[model samples]
Target: MNYFKKLLLILIVLGAKLPLIAQVKLPALVGDNMVLQQNSKVNLWGWASPNEKINIQLGWQTAPVVITANPDGTWKTAVDTPKGNEKAYDITIDASNKIILHNVLIGEVWICSGQSNMYFPVGKEEGTWKTGVVNYEEEIKNANFPNIRIFTVLTKASQKPLDDVTGSWKECSPASVKSFSAVGYFFGRNLYQKLNVPIGLIASSWGGTKAEAWTSEKVLEENTDFLPILENDAKNEKLYQEKLEAYYSDLKKERIANNNDLSKSQLKKPKKEDNKTSYVLYNAMLNPLVNYTMKGVIWYQGESNAEQAYLYRSLFPAMVKNWRNDWNQGDFPFYFVQIAPHKGQNPDIREAQLISSKSIANSGMVVTTDVGDANNIHPIDKQTVGYRLSLLARAKTYNEPNLVFSGPIYNNMKIKKNRAQLFFDYAESGLVKNGDVLKEFEIAGEDKVFYPADAKIEGKTVVVSSEKVKSPVAVRFAWKAIPEPNLFNKEKLPASPFRTDDW
Candidate 1:
């Protein structure tokens, strides 16, 4: 061969190699050492030179599946995930690149979402946060859900939808379970014990994140009822960056002035003009895996939006519908942990959650007013939060018999003379008080000046009467901050926080 001809061939080879190196990229969620969902169809995707071939293999199945990259340099493949133990998987693309995912498990999968309460783990505990009927250590050791794996979605907000998230899946073992959402773990453990199946939990959450952040901007814009909140988001995003910086600066100064450490799970001063709050996280985190199939979702949020109680009545339902539509799974059993008791206010936000829970279709809420801490926003007793969520799964999702799902929910009321007669839907085992008289019942006439009312459990109903109001028009139970509410069913679940009057 002539020298000129050989030199030209080498140049062509080198040019081809450069494109191979620069044109290939993998989605963060599909990187090395990841776990795929089992007993169902799991998604695997990434980017490469347009029109390149991609192949994926799993322990549960034989033979690799081939796919072609799109014009936009994206590729996707769904594997019929198998139920199995911790195993290794190799996914190869175009016979040149390969990703090895280790320690993958297959079983029932769930999504645990919310603010910090659902994000709180057993490791991040503070003594100030306490709860009732929680046995943390026992639940942890007894959590032999080896087949149960968990993948946590990081807190990232975006202006538009994303294709891949920045995290991978991990098994639900002692080592990995410590950082897993405590409530999610307990909920899965309960299901594992009851159903004896593998469980995968996807916890996508952020501390102090409002409900609007997890929802898509398009969905928010579509809902005219939620337009006000979405409008505020546009305004805040425009004015937020600088205000956020200033707010952090003040927060740092306050901590330093008080000789306190801001690193102790504390947030800084509120930004004056942060309008970009609504759709940021939706694009970054949730949009990446909008179609991840799951048996159900366990939500534990609402502290950040507690003040906007009325607004949440619309925002919460819109977000749920948006998610169900995005998943395209026909309302696959939406279950969530009711906002537990948090900081000064006891049951108002809980009531808001109850209102949203009833509003959504094919959905149920787990009441936690009985499991709240007045001083701490992040309650440490996540065991109950998870177990109760799983209980809803037991009766509603898995069709298990003899499991009580919820407390007394106000179905209807009859006002006669000075007293109101209340009837409940799920009054399983009837009504009973554990200790003091039902503490949160209040009565008011047309004036709506609430006065303490006497309450007595009559069969499945709690008759509330007030001497101050001769003709009672309304009644509220467990509706105040740090309210001494005490109405429960014989099954031990707390009665949902409710008010008879619109106000």
Candidate 2:
């Protein structure tokens, strides 16, 4: 009996020791078909047993990097990447165990994120609501770019920041591209075609989510304008249980009324889901991607924040600053699409986006005034949106100085004797009205009442005049909530909406 006890004790000790030798793990991004940012030192991190020595070997480089896990079982190392090419690479890591990442590429890795428009897929397989883009069948059939890779973050929301997300790199093909974000796919395709380099797209977008959901909590806390959001969220949390109980009671009453054929109108609305809570998605979707190196980011959200458009001017820039700070990259390129001309969107939100684009360094905004559909919030012309974004990338990020990527933007206005002369910027090759007649221009006098103004292109400046207004103090162009833009640059890019009056 003593001998049996000794054997059992020895087995128990061995079992306890087995778990101490933890198997080395990697983040979801550092896997098969992944693309590392080219010509940069990209961060590669993972977890292992405390004090364990981790060895990393890159197929493209000769020197192997060695690191030690911290007390918390986390380790990080940066590896140098070569310029973008078609060659496939490998990464081998060994610690308590071995992990080999296959088919890695060196190229421009971009993060495509925002709301429903950015989440819309290239084909119909994503869900019942995501009914692919226009000519999606042809687009899918032609999506065979072997050099382009895609990684989509799984839809998940959390109140606290997560270390890693759930995703895997996929090579671009008909089968794999079917469920990919249409805007992301088209953007990558255009980049590959223009630069002739491999493109890796990381898509982390949720439909109908607000911009604050993707912004860091710290950012929202620092800004005074966003304090209301936090305060309201806290109050809402406190009331949530009571609200839920009331919802159930109301639901029960509605059920009884329905059974009696009386009415269902008394049913109460349930509290908003946790996913819509501020900073939830950032904690889940964006926090895990903070360290991943990327060339730039493309955003396509703002409709959800239209009600708070006035606040977005401050909040949006703060969010961009927060992202740049977390990435430790100095003002990396950030291009965004202006909210299209849908009935639900207001001019305030569009103006806020324009303000962000103008204020944020190394950033650009694509205007979708002409392409937006009034009936459908998710416009089917995603191709034009992607194409315009690529133009900005090609011009700004890729060092193509000769490319005219932007349409005419209002530079300054001169009011002289009842006529307003609007000087424009980016009127490359001169400005030309889209239709036979110029429209959507309004001029206001000192009384602040606006009247239809006759606008005509005179060189790079547009002259606006009204028969009634004797002294035009302000001028506006395409300032309505939904406008069919009629002005375009020689490149056919539509001019962004503008108003001279702050009120």
Per-residue lDDT over 306-337 for candidate 1, one digit per residue giving the tens place of the 0 to 100 score: 77877888888888888888877678788876
Instruction: Identify the leading candidate in terms of lDDT.
Output: 2
C-alpha-based local distance difference test score of model 2: 0.90
Error of 2 at 393 (Å): 0.9
| TM-score of every model versus the real structure | 0.84, 0.94
Summarize candidate 2's per-residue lDDT along 1-503 as a digit string, tens digits.
69999999999999988856778999998899998999999999989999899999999989899999998898888888888899998899988799999999899999999998998899886355456889999999999998999999998999899999999999999999988889999999999998988999999999899888888888888778899989878898879978888888877777786885635375557757776788999999999998899999999999999999989998888888888999888999999999999887789999999889999999999999998889899888889999999999999999886898888888899988979999878995888887888989999999999998999999888999999999899998888788876998888988889998897
Clashing pairs in 2: none
Q: How many pairs of residues in model 1 come into backbone collision? A: 14
What's the true lDDT of residue 197 in model 2?
82
Task: For each candidate in the order shown, give its overall lDDT on alpha carbons.
Answer: 0.74, 0.90
